[model samples]
Target chain A: MKRGVFKRSLDSLESIFLFTSEFVRENHVDPSLLPAIDLIVEELFTNMVEHSSASTADVPMEMSTVDGGVEVTLTDEDADPFDITKVPEVDVERAVEELDPGGLGLHLVRKFADSVEYHYQFSNRQARIVFRKTAGSGGDDV
Target chain B: MFDLERREAGEVVLKGRFDAAQREKAQALFDEIHESVTLDCSELDYISSAGLGVLLKTQKRLLAEGGRLKLIGVNSHLRDVFKYSGFDRIFEIEPG
Candidate 1:
């Protein structure tokens, strides 16, 4: 598994994207799947930055090649326990005027990723989210 | 500071990435415009949720005043983002 650490600031978003892009390219991940992975990373990273109450949010991430897919784990230290996988999905049929921006980030993460799991460690006061996506698994929408 | 690149046809062409860093500038750009506008995003490669929120707010304001905010030249990558966020149903997306 390849690992990296990112600061919990909005500016760190670009670094995450750049690192993931290079990682995907080096690992031979399918080019078509990059966008799905990109969106997932952004949403999760930003969620941690905006919602977490931790004074030092060091986002530690790992990426590895699995059987017919890629596995990813994102960890963050926060004062409160948060489970992003539990966020309820929003109704897509809502009128444009009624569509609020909240919750769309996690909603998209669940929609595009093949598998998502969340875990919180009370001892360490940290939250971890894992995801796995296989080539051609997300969708042909992109 | 975010650069506002406008075209002669009243289309705002967004280039490169639009992230949280550009949120304030983008909001200011939207605040000054009140007419119907089409955002040309053919050159846009990436947009974060903050940027999406700006677009959503602008669309909401435009819709309230009977004006329209359309998106044209959205590539499949960005289209997927819109589709997942349910913005595809809200905005008129012209084929690239």
Candidate 2:
């Protein structure tokens, strides 16, 4: 299995796509997993930029092949020690008129990825999120 | 970056990435509305939660005002995104 790592500057939201797509292309990730991987990467990177207190940190991203699929690890050094997997699920059952859009990102991320893990290094104030997506996997819950 | 192209009436073509950075620009499209609107997303490559949020807001507004939101030309990748997010049931998505 090949391991690829890179640091992305959050200066522009464009880097999120550029970095992720470039990584996917370089690593020859499965085409079937592109959407899930793309969504997972986008949500995590955007959340870091919008919510994290860090103004200028090169977010670390790691990608590797696993037994059933691919694993993505995103490290935010300046972000608060929070577990994304613990975020409350969106009320998808709510009527379209009553639906709330604010909390769907993490929920969708969790649903799209097969397994999600969180790690925080208190000493360095870093939070690392590991998302695994099996090939041909479908979303678990809305 | 995202591109908005107007086709006929009540239809807007979407291209490129629709994400947080493009939300404001995308939301501005909702300022003027008629009885209905359709977004042609054949060229759209990606959408994030922020982009989806804009659609939700617009859809609610349109429905409240007796208008409808129809999505056309959704590629399979985006369709999966909508389906996994459970948006397939919320909106009328037409395949390309």
lDDT winner: 1
After superposition, candidate 2 runs with Cα above 4 Å error: A1-11, A139-142
Displacement of residue A24 (Cα, Å) in model 1 is 0.9
Restricted to chain B, the TM-score per model reads 0.90, 0.90
Model 1 residue B74 CA deviation in Å:
0.9
Among these predictions, the greatest TM-score belongs to 1
Q: lDDT tens string, model 2, A16-98?
A: 56655666677677666766677788788778877885546777677787765688888887667778877877877777767
Which residue pairs overlap in candidate 2's backbone? none
Query: In each prediction, how many residue pairs overlap at the backbone (N, C-alpha, C within less than 3 A)?
Result: 0, 0
Q: In candidate 1, how many Å is residue B92 off? A: 0.8
TM values, all candidates:
0.92, 0.87
Give the C-alpha miss distance for residue A68 in model 1, angstroms.
3.8
What DockQ, between 0 and 1, does each candidate earn?
0.58, 0.51
